[model samples]
Target: MINLFRSYNPLNILWLAVLVIALRIGYIIGAPDKLEFVFVESFARLLVPVSYEYALTPFLNVLLAGALVFAQALLLNKLVNQFNLLGKPSFLPALMYVTISALFTPFLILSAPLICNFLVIWMLYKLFSLYKGDDIKSSGYDLGMIVAIGSLIYLPFIYMFLAVWIALIIFRPFNWREWIAVILGYATIFFFLAVLYYLNDRFHTFYKIWLPLGTQFPNHISINNYTYVLLAPVVFILVLSVFKLQQGFFKSYVHIRKAFQLLLIMFIIAGLSFYVKRQFQLNHFLLCVVPVAITFAYYFLYTTSKWFYESLYLLLLAGIIYFQFNTF
Candidate 1:
């Protein structure tokens, strides 16, 4: 399977579809009767002024989510190849993304963080272009708005605003205007939201959106031990990818190095920002899959041991399918 995706072939998409179904089939068969889809965050509910939670049959829920994951994987793969991030094109990123997105049951269904991934990919495309463009103030502003939009879907997504500044620092010189443009961009969305609040006579509740920012980090998070077991392969691959990157970090082109650095920061911010949501769940980490899949692609592309990498990827697939059928 790894060998099949190691090259960029259009036919591989058929295999990717099969992979998506196979990974999700077990859960779909045993899924709960009622699946709740949270289309937006609570504050966003007020802003959109519609039903945020909708109940759907298990099969329909998984099917829609599967379609979304497939589309996002292709989009991310396009972005990776566009920038020559992996030195050459391959379907590995898409394959890895489909695999990673199914790592947890919650991720296999429709949720706010899963929906926000499209914005994450859009941000990456604009973020990577910063290196080539002469003036990126527009890009900064767009990114700020993008992050704000994503925050509307998932509140923790607000932290991605930091990545806009980090990208400016890595890809461009110190320009205060570019730095400040992001803030104005972020506020642009909220300004309208504030207006809506005032018109609705709910201006008093507008301040509650930022209250989560002040919440203290929990001393400990109670997670099932099996969740760690499920993450074992993910941890192994990330550690290997880090060492593999470190080995050739300076050897890569300047733009590529900075791009990877920015991605690493984005991953950290996305992963840690979940603490801000009082009712966070594993699905929130779907925001990290784009960067993590790219990192996995890097290691798989460069690693010389064909048999070892092949077996490692197989182990990951087997684990995902196995866990889906039998719960810990």
Candidate 2:
């Protein structure tokens, strides 16, 4: 399976579809009784007046979400290759993304973070463009607005505002206007939202939108033991990827090195920002999948030991399927 996706091939799409179905087989078996069809976070409804009621059955919902995530994984693969983040173009990023997106059952469904991933990809594209562009302020504004829009879907996503500033520091010289542009662009979204609230005579509730930012970090989260067991392969792969990154850190090009640094910051911010939601959901961690997938791709593409990497990849897939079915 690893060998099949190591190269860039259009035929991989068929295999990817098959792989998606395989990963989702557990959800399909349980169907409408055990799975949820439409999941909307409380804050999501507060931010957006509309609700998503597809009127579709649970099986159809799972199928549609699987299709959407697969499509996004492919798009993310293209974005990484287009930016030369992996040093060379390959299908490994897309393959890794499809695998990781199914690591948890919550991630298997259509959720806010899944939707926000499109914004994450867009922000990354704009951030990479900074390497060659002269207009830092315009790029900063665009990134800020993208983060703002994403925050509307998942409030914790506002944390990505930090990535915009961090990317500016990585790609360009110090500029105060660039910093201010990010703030202004972020405020622009809420400004209109406030007006909508005022027009509806619910202006007082506008302040409540920021309440999540004040959530205190809990001392403990009750994670199932089996979940940790399922995480073993993922943790192992990330450790290897980090070691691999450190080994070649200095040998990479200047842009590529800085890009990886930016991604590292993104992973940290995305992971830590989950506290802002106050309610701990595995779905929130989906925010980290983009950077994590890129890191995995780097490991698979550059590692010399074919058997070791192949075994690791297969182990991850097997663990995901086993845990998915056993969870019930």
Candidate 3:
């Protein structure tokens, strides 16, 4: 399976779909009867007028989420290839994405972070374009709007707005206008949302939206110790990937280095942004999967030790399936 995805063959997509189902099957079979599809944040929910009674059945919900994951995997794969983020074109990013997205059952369901991933991909496209050194004030504004839209779906996604500036810093010379353009673009969305709040006589409630931003990071989160065992393979793979990148870090192109820097910054921002939400949900980390998947693909793409990388991938797959069934 690892070798199959290591090639860029179009036929590999069929196998990728099969892998998606295999990874998700255990959770789907054991899924509870009620599976809520939550695509909007609490503040946005109030304005959007969602009906609780309109929820999809668990099977269909999982099916739709699986389809979304597949679609996202393909999009992410395209993005990595388009930018040549990986040395050569291959489906490894897509494969790694599906695998990591299924690492937690929470990631298998419909959630705000899952929905926001599309915006994240979109932002990456614009971010990468900054490498051309073209005037990108418009791009900055667009990225800000993307972040705003994502924040409407998942509040933690607002942190991605920092990525807009971070990309500019890494990819372009100092341009204060471009820097401020992103802010204007971000405010552009909320400006209208504020007007809607005032018209509906709920303007007072609008201030409450930023309240969560002030919440202190938690001292600890309640998670099963066994979950760490499940994550061991993932952590191991990421560490290996980081070390591999470090070995060749300076030899890589300047743009590749800057791109990786921006990606690392985005990963940290996405991972820590969960603190803004009063309740910590594992699904929130789905935002980090994009960068992590690309990183994994990098390692798998470059590593010469075929036997080791392939076995590690299989081990990761087995861990996912076993834990999905074990439900620990």
Candidate 4:
């Protein structure tokens, strides 16, 4: 794996960049309503304090949001690159990882938590790479601070506390100091966001946002249509891989054995999806999507390296374009 990175050609980077751009173009072309506004008005109205006469501009929000989405694609790409050594997920996998991040992950640009996604990825990377007794406490504290800032942007992102704590324990075992730092992270979000609310004169919204457990919010909603766009094929390959694992195909193959980390990441995303949906917070949240993207990237390369698997991915891409591209 180390040699692969060192020996990789510059053209490969260009190819990956071109492919990523192709994905952005395809997404813009096929987006439902295609750059035209639909329901963001309601959100814009919700962004400003009721007392403020001027609502935030939807145009600016979406334009800014588009930039964030593009940035997320880049981040997801780098994330796959950074972690690929763990699973050896490749350039194609990076594309798939990024797509899943953008496609179905919680909180799209319309949601405030987009900011959290950016911050959490960096913190998680640091957490994932930490060594034994290497200041998990400080990392956790920094993680907490990032969450506090993210929550100020979108309140529910406080949930990222779950990710931060879990990552700390999984990737780097911690002691009492780290746990305290995690607690500090949670408390900091509340304190800082409250300060923002007080300044905005919308102090009441802060309580509703922070103490969500008290509210009887309606079930979150989403349309599952066209998930076959990617899910069916990805699932089939995963099923085959699972069967192979059961049959001991991976007994001696180190990379195949290690790829289960990608599987774990995928599971985390799926679990978080249901968690977010139950709360009616259906925006494309970063937490749900980041793992999904990693899973997709891992498997995309996994399938593409085999003749049968490569054929399947081609068919899947063709089907997705056929089903999804007509709107373009």
Most accurate candidate by lDDT? 1
Write candidate 4's Cα lDDT for 100-203 as tens digits: 44443223234555555676567646655554346667777777887666555554555566666666556554577887887886677567556766776877
Candidate 2 at residue 70, lDDT? 88
Candidate 1: list runs displaced more than 4 Å: none
After superposing candidate 2 on the true structure, give the runs of residues whose Cα lies further than 4 Å from its correct spot. 32-54
For residue 328, give model 4's deviation from the true position in Å.
13
Task: Output the better candidate (1/4) by lDDT.
Answer: 1
Clashing pairs in 3: none
Q: What tens-digit string does per-residue lDDT give for candidate 3 at 1-328?
A: 7788889999999998998889888998899978777778778776678585337988888888899999999999999998888778999999999999999889888888998988988898889889995788998889989999998988889889888887887898998999999999999999999998888889999999888888999999988776788789999999999999999889888888988999899999999999998777989999999999999999999998888988999998898898888975
For model 2, residues 110-144, the per-residue Cα lDDT tens digits are 77888888888889888988888887788788788
Candidate 1 per-residue lDDT, tens place, 66-128, comes to 999999999999999999998889999999999999998899999989999999999999999
lDDT values of the candidates? 0.91, 0.85, 0.89, 0.51
Question: By TM-score, how accurate is candidate 2?
Answer: 0.95
Cα-based lDDT at residue 12, candidate 4: 48
List the pairs of residues colliding in candidate 2.
none
TM per candidate comes to 0.98, 0.95, 0.97, 0.67
Where model 4 places Cα greater than 4 Å from the true spot, the runs are 1-7, 24-84, 87-89, 101-116, 154-156, 172-174, 200-205, 214-224, 240-286, 300-305
C-alpha RMSD in Å of predicted model 3 compared with the true structure: 1.2
List CA RMSD, all candidates: 1.1, 1.8, 1.2, 6.0
